[model samples]
Target: MAKLTTRGLRIDSGGTGGGPVTIAAEDVAGALGMGRLKPQAVLVGRATFCDDNRAQLELAKWVQQELHRRCRRNGWKTDYCEGLAQLCVFELVHPLRCVHCLGRGQLWLQVPERRGERIVLVERWRTCPRCKGSGRKRLTVRDRAAVAQIGKSQFADVWAERADAMLSDLYGLQDDVLRHLWKQFADEAA
Candidate 1:
């Protein structure tokens, strides 16, 4: 098992073999050949990267569980569940979202008629500043509200329902295929 701590979070990343086992640092890319490594290491807000071995992942799980238990014992009602959902979904599925245009792909380059100078064929499209070229504004068209509900957990049921369809179509993976792979894969690095 591998163990590490960063920003006060502990990670225990080893486990039974054939499943995901958090390997040493140099082992992660090599481990890619063995199998996919799920990002089992949970993290706090905006935290990225973690120890990916059995010991480190285990400790991470333990810390989070303890925090939740303590919160529950004292009736703090921490929103860990929602946070976790957001973390997992964003971590797992963000790349898929990147493929989408987010309603903004390009804009026509401003062309000027100088009447004599050779007509410079400007590049056809320029990136949108609003969406940062991701084409998706943080605001929804209907609600005109910021896109705080993007991650997951906070998603409305209707959105989730639509998202399932989108996921099925966009990923080109059937629900069963994802479940099968997810059940088997434990070493997704990216």
Candidate 2:
């Protein structure tokens, strides 16, 4: 079971010592209240610490149903709908770190600066070009196509759009869970 507190959100991790895991309120507030999507809050959104994983399961089921409906409407075979939905949910829940920036979403570049007739290199951070500051790697076309059981051309032409929609819905589900956690924290504080 998980408990929301003014200090933090506590979950029984069932570790070797049987101690509960506590996530700071500040972290929760930053991730949920400010929509920063910090790692701890993301884990919470995955329902990892909860006794029942109904929220995530329900959202995944919704994604699968929506994808099936869209595939039928588009006259595409729905045989791979479950796999496609699973892929989308996995992307939403466990996004890979951007390799380019090493998940920092920024790069430290040495810039030449002139100070008192001397040239010195100063380190400055810039947003990562590869991930566009998102810090997450995108699913490749080949992988997505394989998951959808479609050719790359067809996936690129039409299936990708449907996949993106399902991904968006998964994001919405995460946001909704975060919002609910935020409300619970607020209520606890009151």
Candidate 3:
């Protein structure tokens, strides 16, 4: 298997055959390699992006495991830890985008309109009820506390700070991975 690494971008030929093959810059060398592919940069960029996304997901799982460990050490129940950890992972991976309007802050509703001799359905835009025009999901303090498996006051005082730090680290990792992928592509293009 070919292994390639540039900065933090790694592409190893060790995935299932059905999945995308992450080809690195080194793998593009020689006649029988990816050099034969026209617009090699675009294909390589896509593969690199996919690999980075997979890496981010793995990092999110690590964050969940760390959160679960903290919960156990803090005497939280084991049964709740798994679900709460998963929730934290979801929040870490997905941005605070509204699911209802898909972050558009508006929805198109079909309403009945009377037009002379017939009733017609007209599409009208309305502010999203879930996000209330904010275009972002409302993750309340109560909900955060629930995920932390602690009282609201305790969560605000202690767990909130810790969780925020963890989330920041995860975001930083994602940013770094993207930067690395971009750098790799730039190097390849040169």
RMSD of each: 15.9, 9.7, 13.7
**What lDDT score is found at residue 138 in candidate 2?**
84
Estimated TM-score for each candidate: 0.26, 0.58, 0.42
Residue range with the least summed lDDT across 10 consecutive positions in model 3: 12-21
Q: Per-residue lDDT tens digits of candidate 3, residues 91-187?
A: 6544487989987778999988999999999999988898886566846879877766778887677566667766555545444443444344445
Q: What are the lDDT figures for the candidates, one per model?
A: 0.36, 0.66, 0.53
lDDT of 2 by residue, 49-120 (tens): 232266456656767887889888989888778777767866766678899998777899998999998999
Note the residue pairs that clash in candidate 3. none
Between prediction 2 and prediction 3, which has the larger TM-score?
2
How far does residue 31 in candidate 3 sit from its true spot (Å)?
20
Instruction: Compare candidates 2 and 3 on lDDT and give the better one.
Output: 2
